[model samples]
Target: MSQRHVLQVFEQYQKARTSSCQTVAELANRPQNVETLQNAGVMSLLRPLLLDVVPTIQQTAALALGRLANFNDDLAEAVVKGDILPQLVYSLAEQNRFYKKAAAFVLRAVAKHSPHHAQAVVDCGALDTLVICLEDFDPGVKESAAWALGYIARHNAELSQAVVDAGAVPLLVLCIQEPEIALKRIAASTLSDISKHSSELAQTVVDAGSIAHLAQMILNPDEKLKRQVLSALSQIAKHSVDLAEMVVEAEIFPIVLTCLKDTDEYVKKNTATLIREIAKHTPELAQLIVNAGGIAAVIDCIGSCKGNIRLPGIMMLGYVAAHTENLAMAVIVSKGVPQLAICLADEPEHHIKAASAWALGQIGRHTPDHARAVALANVLPRLLSLYMDAESSEDLQVKAKKALKNILQKCTHLPALEPLLHDAPPNILKHVVGQFSKVLPHDSKARRLFVTSGGLKKIQEISAEPGSLLQEYINTINNCYPEEIVRYYSPGFSQTLLERVDQYQPVI
Candidate 1:
């Protein structure tokens, strides 16, 4: 019940060569007893018991210390300070399977507490020991070792490299495909953590033939395993287009599509994220995802409960829209314009707002009607707000400004158009004049409004150059303008004057 009582029991158990040591060790494994043992500085007492001649004493002692170390930073520091790592590392090769397993379990708990704890384990040469145990004959030892390696590699780049250099990757890949479903899951998770450290480490795993294994594993219907495998693939795909192409080559797209239909929220969310990364590199590649019905699934995620899910969904939709005119139209017809407007106006994340704004511009850039639709959503003000915000990132400002230019250029709304046209670029002027040409024929009010606003003079000036591309637009204006007005504005081309010139023509 008291710390001194547990310590005295531990001392008595250490001396006895009977099952009494096992009983005391099991008592120490109890939560209440472990707390007493830990608070009383029993690690020094337990350290020698880790290598006790009896397997149960060693197992129980290791298990008890591991339980205490998992509680908090101070306990873990105490476990490391008690110099338990070298004994744990040595125990991996022990003749008793339980000793190896218990040591690995304790080591995993210690290493997972913090990077410093993990580095301490590494400093004691746990990485190399663990890599050997990855190939152990006992499934329990192999699984424990693999799990421990994953925790070490979670945040330690050097340990990850050390693990990889010691040849952990291919073995882990082998473990993933084995019949033990639990081990396969742990190996898959470890591989994901390993790949997260760097592209070079990820590429090492990929180069060792993990992609095909991962692709097959993805179809296994294990929700947690699927999440980990997808995350690893995403990390790999993010580094280079060539590797992304490899993911496609493995026919991973269909599996990814299937994952989008998973019941698990994380699986669905991560699937959208991976597609977003793959779609970013090239339009051709993006089209593959769209062709696989990724657009509709991703559009649905725009309203996901989680912001992380929703943000990537909005971002993926934007990237997909940027790829093609038809895809952009697909987004518009899916009611994506209003959804994007919402993200721009109300989404708290500036990058999400920026992505939504850019997507709106892409959608509207295809035609005038699309631009008008986006502007009609009252998104113009929000876009202007983002573009002008001093606190907005440069990328956000740049996206907002481009979207504004696009919407304003194609917008038929007078208030939106007039300001833009007064300072329109040459190409934008062409689009504006083109819009006017379409409306002037059916509406006399439009014709008069155009002529009175110096639009006629602008057209005439455009027509002055014979070889200009605007010649056709100028010709349309000449055809559309009333005959009296044309003659008044351009007496040089009068029919009577042309007839007089024909009568005075020289003969050959």
Candidate 2:
């Protein structure tokens, strides 16, 4: 078949396939005919047909090529490597909304398949054309253009820089401010992608003072827009620490806190995750979280949230507890212990359980009083019970044992330590003994616990015949705690403990 003849056949097929009267079922059964045309180099020959088609045919051709984009790279390459790109660019200048959207879809496919094609599209002035589509009266066209620009910016840095140079930021910022939630979402996402490659663009976004507007969107009546804003903030926070600080300083915490109560699981989950990222970098912001009454909101989420939200919430609270002693105390005072304890009790997800255990340890570390508070909450007994339960996995058992050890260590001064020491279950005692023996000299409190509690007596009894227990305990103490703590009180105590351990090789 001649190239010209094949092109004619492809055009005929294209005309037949695009008719609104033609059923998709009819097109589906005609693969043989389609293959005959394709085998005759139809895609290669149809490049010119792309340029001459009316808006309807151009749209039809663009949609067909988008579908064929994944199936055959040759057709996609032909479309992009040929004058079809200029035609697509020209289509964007048209007033017809459908043609503009179709043109944007084709550009998206081209950008997805080939970075070179994306560059080519950009060189064809596609960026300026698409940016104008942001103002198009048709929302669908705006959405398609926003999506296409996002992909283009993600794949091509120069194109992204060009988009930023073309004043795309203000337009995108306007899109984010749009009353239409969907358009705002796509615009925010596109802005996020642009910001990743160009910090200048991120600064541009920040300069537009979009953070406050974004925070308002988080409280928007549309739940979908709230989610989009939260997600965008997460992305922005990842790139710019200044923007992150601004997010906190803007008092966006309350908005995010409210999102925790949203009925949509995705909204709550994303809000929790955003809160975690925000809290992790700016530990000082944990106080802001507390000030906004986020603790109760986050704690409330633990009961009904799925693992997605629950784990991050657990992790964030743990982060807060670790950073701020006062916040940790407040969490305990606000009854956060019971919620976390119950989550550990009822939620079987390992990561969730791990986070809970970690948060409990943080609480234990912050204040001995708070540690005793959790112990009094009865979480220790349940954690200890994990050791004996046949259903518990080894990982869960380890976490449970670790948390129990922290609880015990913290509560050593509390009266509850007496019962835990004497009436405590056997497995609990074994874990405590194992932990005590492993205590490093740097861990003064643990060393202190070993010395103050009956750990010293237990070591003495075990080492009575050989004295190896004393050496092992001494060696562990010298190695584990921080150098500063050891230096402050012990001086060369670390070396002395190791020397004593080395001198005697008695077996326990």
Candidate 3:
């Protein structure tokens, strides 16, 4: 690792080139030694060894350069600038499986740092060699080649299209069906990376018959494989309704729901995310999950996980509830509001809390029973508090305000609203006062309390613009009371005194 130690590894007569190369590779494997080895100009030494007459020496030198590059971007660029990639790519077609694996690894390590480095590998014609390597008798070379292509494709749409042009998708699909779990996991992940960039890219993967092959792995006992498989499905399903329908047609549900209960948190998270993507497309698609009991399973997933893990499940509930009143009721009936309420109240993250508030509004905005369900869960007051908090981000404030406006317009429960009058800003107060105007006029007891509890006085205190809707609401409430009480509650005096005259009696 030290400069002195690196020189000793290359003392050509003291140790065979193979032994020296292997020593450096092993030492570089320890992350702490990577920088020291690089600073000693080990890249300069490893450059020639990449083409050594002994194949193992070439393999180990590539392995050492890869370990150094894998440590950070600087070394990755060093590999690119060291002129090692052309040799590595050149050797891929000719080397034995072990040498090919090490060379492919060097490319993957170099490429993973950034698109610039990946593009450098492609400029040297690594893709054609890698694509051919995909068919090699050795599965190790195939897996390594797959990883390099995946890393290249991940950086941008142009690069992903490039990988597609090289015809990696069908081969990747083949890798997905292979017997090795690691190969399946990486293959699935690469498909996800490839499909995520654009609809065209996703359609390419689908055309390769990836959906059924991927669907078969949904319940695979390997948690890591299941995560990638779910993630890949989520990516493909995200592009369009037709694509989502194709995923659904696989009959992978009910069983996909079982993944929601997986012990691996990522599997659970990705499962929820996959369901979220599908349900977002259509009411009928959402209904599939509901029929499969997705609502209860997702709520349990939300309840069991925390932080970002809960986000997709929370949104799954929102998407389902957002589709229709019946679906919303399904969420409510499944005890979703309290879980959402808990997220809104307790989660430290603003975005998750914002999601919870928005979902609650969707659930509550439908009808009085729905609004009452949200009300009973103590959700509105908390939503109001989030809206009023100055520290909340503008996005959070916007979502909270929209949720409030939507829910309060449908809310008929008055006790839940009384506290809002003191705290709501002018915009929200209009809804609260309007709810009061609707109820107090019909219930004598509420009308009496509106006066006795100083509710009328609170209405009088609001500085509503003369012709605004708030002023109109005040006039309507004044008609509910005797003219004297109306005049007494008026801010100063009122032309509305005559507006209230219908309630007056025995006037001269």
Candidate 4:
């Protein structure tokens, strides 16, 4: 139908009987009718009907306007520009229940689709009205009102603070505790959105006692609601050490950890991510996660999860190790080393390699035994492969080399370290030489392995060149290796032949 015909239909509905007006309201709510209503300027005609004397006509107009606003930013802007927010805001206080619900629905749709529309709603002082609607006797009105404020808070920081300033936090906390599942879910979502915008705002929500309610909400089987609550906790944890400690102090780490096995990928992913964030704060926090039996969940995620989850899972394991020796011991006991070894071996993406390799290094850093665990995983070969590759970026090579150094420091049992020196970058070869010199005297097997693998000779060859940095390593080997072995190997090669003739044969 042409725009003119749609306008005529809306006009007819305005004067029609109650049933007919409801029919028009239902029709206007159709997905196909939005363009007709918008193109025909039907929303403008419906604005006055928001205050109509007959409640049914008012419901029809507001509901139709809401339908038009859903997911359409320009139309939402048009609605706000139509000076309709105040009308909706006023109607929120109406004694007629349907009018209040419909007005909230319209406001929610408008706020949800556009940041500009959300700010417009906030500027019209809708938060206080929405806060009142939180106590509405109608559950539907309460849900939509909470949902609308959520949309507003989700837009940006200033408005999020505005929502908190207007006292939405405690109301949201109450909504989560309510029996109505839908209202609780929407309130949780609002709290989550607010927490993500800024640390101060997140603290405000937590200060209002939202964390406990949010934690309690996690026990519900509703995956969607659980996802939002976990995400909120994760975002809040990301703010600072104190907030992360707060999340753990609430004793919710176990609940968050259990979500690692959630059937939903998003929930699993967010849960894994939350573990990383929380464990990053301190040894106590890391120990809290480990004590709650979260390490097994992190291991499970790294071992089994698909997509991007595995990388963060690997990282979380490493982060835990770096925090404390006991936690590092826990990761080792959990067999995280082998899993991390597998991640490095799988030809995964560079980032995955970097995170895994860096984590292995962290695990090795905890203690000599932890280093032995990493070394026993046989990651040295993979790490060396990445480090020696000419094509790898500097950061990746650095991570690989650092992991190799850390692991090899505590374990002398490895394949030939000589191959690691071949064609290694200057810094990497220097490291290999230094490692050899450190071990050559104390470790007989490593001494035999180094000489047989030809690394010592290679160091000798490299050190003779002009301006070589390998000179210090040569000195170390000379000073530390068995004296007779060093004598037979080099035989005073830097001395003149004539001067050496007394102790060695002169060439003819």
Candidate 5:
């Protein structure tokens, strides 16, 4: 049969059946007529027939209207504001399980598209009613009700509050606790939607002990449920600080750490994000992360993984590095430098490499001893290689340049620079000089002289008198270089240089 002919016949059937069978066969077939009715503006023509048939043909009409809900908001609003809502609500009370299940499915679709219908669904006292249906002997009814409640909670804050008010937390918590992965998935998504809108509801879930349930699901063998649990925990962590703290307290670091190795990229990414959020509110949790060998795991994630996982894991490592110097040192001691260095070589991603560099910079910032350790690991040459390789690629070039600059600025001592000068790949050394010239401050003659005269190396020469070398270096730059040259080479470096110059001038 031709599609147009079929649609024509279905419309005719709908009109005729308006007075006869309440079956949805005509309505189900009407989905094909959606574009025709919309383009023809025949929605108003069908309105009368729709209202008349809604009661007797509630199932068919509701299903058809649910499908039509996607086409036009005007039609959806008309259906809801008309008599469709009360009929669907009454269907929820039907003794016929099939009708009840069908009505719940229709209502879920309606609520998903129309916020206006959410309160009506709620006011019909369907919150507690749906919670009961969650345990229906028919899995279809249970799934339908759970889905409808999720849509309701998503659109209506009051509906979410009402769900919580009706003690729906325990019910949803039970759903999450169930062994059935499908029900658990529905429960997780439902809780995510509800908690997203109402922090109070999120707290209620937490208070009702959803975290433990959620944390358990994080280990579920099913990858889908694990991903859902990761998402739910991320949302809940955002809403409840105490809950986030409790999650950390529950010693979930090991499980979260293990998720860093998940085959599903999103699962690992979100797990890292959740860990990052947990660390943000409770900085002390960083120690736990370190204790759980999170640093090595994160570095591995950054170096080995791609896309979403790499960026988030790098971010978490940066967070840990910034929060605690000891943890930062732990990363360095864990041989993080070589892993980060290798990532700098192969990682084409600008942000991930940049984050890795930023993490290295933070590690460098902890202490000179730590900076020297990183330098000795031959990290600078690899960073320089990345910078030179990317000099033509706009995005990576900029990040590589900035990362190299930060490394130089933070790790200024000779022990760090000597290996770059002496042992660095020749091409890499050129790149370092290129970056150094670009980043080193101009206008500071004293600073320019100090940097050029190998002040860093001289400082490491234990036999060299610090005062004498500094004075000679300052005098040489002031005499040899033009102000523009000085200004261009070491603009910001002079203050520290001049301060050292003044302190050393008298002592000499």
Candidate 6:
């Protein structure tokens, strides 16, 4: 049928317009037909109906516009260009519960498309209206309004601050305290969006006292709600030390540790992220995690999760070990070293391997025991390989190189150090040779292995300036061996000597 026929359907009597609007909404629900419906000017037909006299026709028209806008950014911008938001925002306050719900959904649909579209909604003065809708007695209206606010706030810092400036936080806190699970999830999620943009905005969220209430939802059996709640807490906690401590002060440490063992991966992932944010700040906070037995739980998380899901746990391990020697020891005692080693060696993604390598560096950098723990896990070779691999990303390569140097400098384990002599770059080789220099002069056993493993041969081939540290280290290692052994291992030692002997004229 022509566009005229579609319009005729809505142009009929009140009952016919209501039926037509509902029919278009249902048809627009299918992804395949949204284009066909839009090409027919379905939006233009539905725009005017948003202000229809009859309640059902008005709300249904709003619902249809929402579905059309929900399909794509183009359609959403069409809704914006078609001048639909102002009517919806205007309707949001004056309409009944159902109409308010439908209008708020339309605003949400439009705002979700882009920052431009969301800004359009904000520019139309939707935020204050949406904030007011949060107070509606009907849970559905409140839920729709909360979702719209989240979409608008999620784009950037300025828009997020605008949502905060419009006074949405306290009412959002109120929504989380409501009995509805859906309401709680969206409210928590919206709060996360608002708080994620800046420390000031996050402080606004914290000052509203959302953490204690969010923490109380931890034991709820709903995985979806738990994800949002954890996300909100993580966002708020990620902003500043005081904010993170506020989350800690709520005593979710033990609960979050237990959550690491939860069957749901999202809960586990978000749980790991929340811990990571807290563990990142200070030694005292890291100690708080250690005292709560967090390292073992995170180790288990790293072991059980595959791919990117393991990322946060890997990062948490790094951040904790980054703080202090005692904290690094806590990670070592929990057997985090081997787990990180396994990730660096086995993970298919370079980013994950980089994260693992970084964490292992943190664990190994503090002291000899920490370094030995990493070296003994057999992680040094894999780190060197990643640094040497041409396919590795620069980020991965840099992290791997850093990790190798860290572990190598403190490592006295001669067996591990011996192999690194053959391949480690000049920068890393210095540390490897430095270790051998420190240890070989004092021990005969390492000197023997140094020759038997061809480590002496590898050292002789390295081209360093006469007075360079690498040459100095090579000279030190050569001194540990007998003079005859050093002479035999020197590069082209026989060929140069034979030519010199043939050209000798000292007697003449």
Residue 263 lDDT in candidate 6: 90
> TM-score per candidate, in order?
0.71, 0.68, 0.90, 0.78, 0.65, 0.93
Compute the lDDT of residue 2 as modeled in candidate 5. 98
Candidate 3, residue 427: Cα displacement in angstroms equals 2.1
By lDDT, the better pick of 2 and 3 is 3
lDDT of 3 by residue, 33-74 (tens): 887888789999999998787777888899888888888999
Which candidate comes out best when scored by lDDT? Answer: 6
Candidate 4 has a TM-score of 0.78
Q: Assess candidate 5 and give its lDDT.
A: 0.65
Clashing pairs in 6: none
Compose the digit string of candidate 1's lDDT tens values, residues 351-425: 878878888887777676777777777787777767778899999999988887777666665434433345454
Segments of candidate 2 deviating more than 4 angstroms: 1-17, 20-49, 68-87, 109-125, 153-166, 195-201, 238-241, 253-255, 342-349, 374-431, 434-508
Residues 1-508 of candidate 5 have per-residue lDDT tens digits of: 9999999998888667663333333443466666665565443443343344345454544555566654556655655665566656655666456666666765676677667767766766677778888877766677677888888887657778877777667777777876677888888888877777656777877787888888877787888888878877877776556767777765677877788788888888878878776655645677777788787787776666765566666666666767666877787777777776666556776666776776676666666566666677676666665666634355555655555555665554443564455444433444333333332345455345445666433322322234653344344434444665545444456586778787885645
Once model 1 is optimally superposed onto the true structure by TM-score, how far is the C-alpha of residue 328 displaced, in angstroms?
3.5
**Full ranking by TM-score:** 6, 3, 4, 1, 2, 5
Instruction: List the pairs of residues colliding in candidate 2.
Output: 440-476, 440-477, 441-477, 441-478, 442-481, 443-481
Model 5 misplaced regions, further than 4 Å = 1-33, 37-57, 70-83, 113-128, 154-159, 197-199, 239-241, 249-253, 334-364, 369-409, 413-508
Estimate every model's Cα lDDT from 0 to 1.
0.77, 0.69, 0.89, 0.79, 0.65, 0.91
Q: How accurate is candidate 2 locally (lDDT)?
A: 0.69
Residue 381, candidate 3: C-alpha displacement in angstroms: 1.8
Question: lDDT per residue, candidate 6, 1-508, as tens digits?
Answer: 9999988776777667778888998999999999899889998899889878898889889888888888899999999999889888888889899999989989999999899999999999999999999999999989999999999999999999999999999999999999999999999999999989888999999889898999999888889999999999999989889999999999997887888888999999999999999999999999999999899999999999888889999999999999999999999999999898888888999999999999999999988888999999988888998999999999999999999888887888888777787888888888888898888899888788888888888888888888998888888888887898898888899998899999998865
The order of the candidates by lDDT, greatest first, is 6, 3, 4, 1, 2, 5
Q: What is the TM-score of candidate 1?
A: 0.71
